[model samples]
Target: MAQFYRLRVHHRQTGEIHDLTVASDRYILHQAEHQGYELPFSCRNGACTSCAVRIRSGEVFQPEAVGLSQELRDRGYALLCVSYARSDLEVETQDEDEVYELQFGRYFGGGRVRFGLPLEDD
Candidate 1:
């Protein structure tokens, strides 16, 4: 069965709000990337809380979140990059406040940098 995650994000800066629909099994970063949302993230793994946020409403699953202290977890802080939604959720994070869009081509070096010979061209 396919899974879906509904997210409501509140921007702390401009007080703007965004409703996002993410896949339940996929990392939140994928959703952010697909939607062109700027998330302050260094490590995409659960070791970093760069994507941390407070769960304003709903439930999420963190399978490998090590950086989240007990107090922080209790306080609703979570790493959005690693967490998967169990239900429709509302989150408040820094990303919404200072939204940034990530250019996919820049990081992957575009299609110019070849990994192997282009079979189609040959």
Candidate 2:
């Protein structure tokens, strides 16, 4: 049996709020888009954090959100491109740069790159 959940989306960047019904079996982003609401997203395959949102209330299931680390997930962050509503959900879009910084800022390099292997002629 399929279940449906009410989703409340808070687009923080635009200050737009949308209330939509989403199914538990499909990607929330897809459903939201179909319902005529626009949301930030990139790399819909769950490999990027462009569609990241913060879960304010209720629960979402995101088994394929590989772009998010357990640390972020534990902190109530989710990638809407791959998330499914497990229950009535309230998610607010995160600032793209903020989420990216939180997720990968530490890994940024401050030094020049040095290659150990010589370039081969093609």
Candidate 3:
């Protein structure tokens, strides 16, 4: 049986509020797109953080979201492109950079780093 759940997606970047019903058997982002909502997304296969969102309420299942870490998932983050509504859901789009930072910044961003090899003396 196909189950439907209410979904409330808030676009923090655009300040758009979309309220609609989504099906548990389909990806949330696709459903929203079918309903004419243009939410941020990139790499619809769930490999990028562009579709990242934070679940403010309710539940979702995203077993294919390889872009997110278990820590981020535990922190209520999900990739809408692969997430399925498990219950009435309330989510807000997250800044991609923020999500990226949370996922990998610890290993890279550590302040100014001199780029390129030292210029050869003339």
| Number of the predicted model whose lDDT against the real structure is largest | 3
List lDDT for all candidates, in order: 0.70, 0.91, 0.94
Work out candidate 3's RMSD over C-alphas: 3.8
Query: Over the stretch 1-122, how does candidate 3's per-residue lDDT look in tens digits?
Result: 77999999999999989999999999999999999999999899989999999999999999999989999999999999999999999999999999999999887788544577765555
lDDT order of candidates, top first: 3, 2, 1
Candidate 3 Cα deviation (angstroms), residue 3? 0.7
Please identify model 2 stretches exceeding 4 Å from their true place. Answer: 109-122
Looking at candidate 1, the ten consecutive residues that score lowest on lDDT are 96-105
**TM-scores of the candidates in the order shown:** 0.68, 0.87, 0.90
Cα error of candidate 1 at position 13, Å? 4.8
C-alpha lDDT (0 to 100) for residue 80 of candidate 2: 94
Residue-level lDDT of model 2, residues 9-99, one tens digit each, is 9999899999999999999999999999999998999988889999999998899999999899999999999998999999899998899
Best by TM-score: 3
RMSD of each: 11.8, 4.6, 3.8
The better candidate by lDDT, 1 or 3, is 3
lDDT of 1 by residue, 16-92 (tens): 78788987887776687789776556677867656777788988888677766666677677778788888889988
Error of 2 at 94 (Å): 0.7
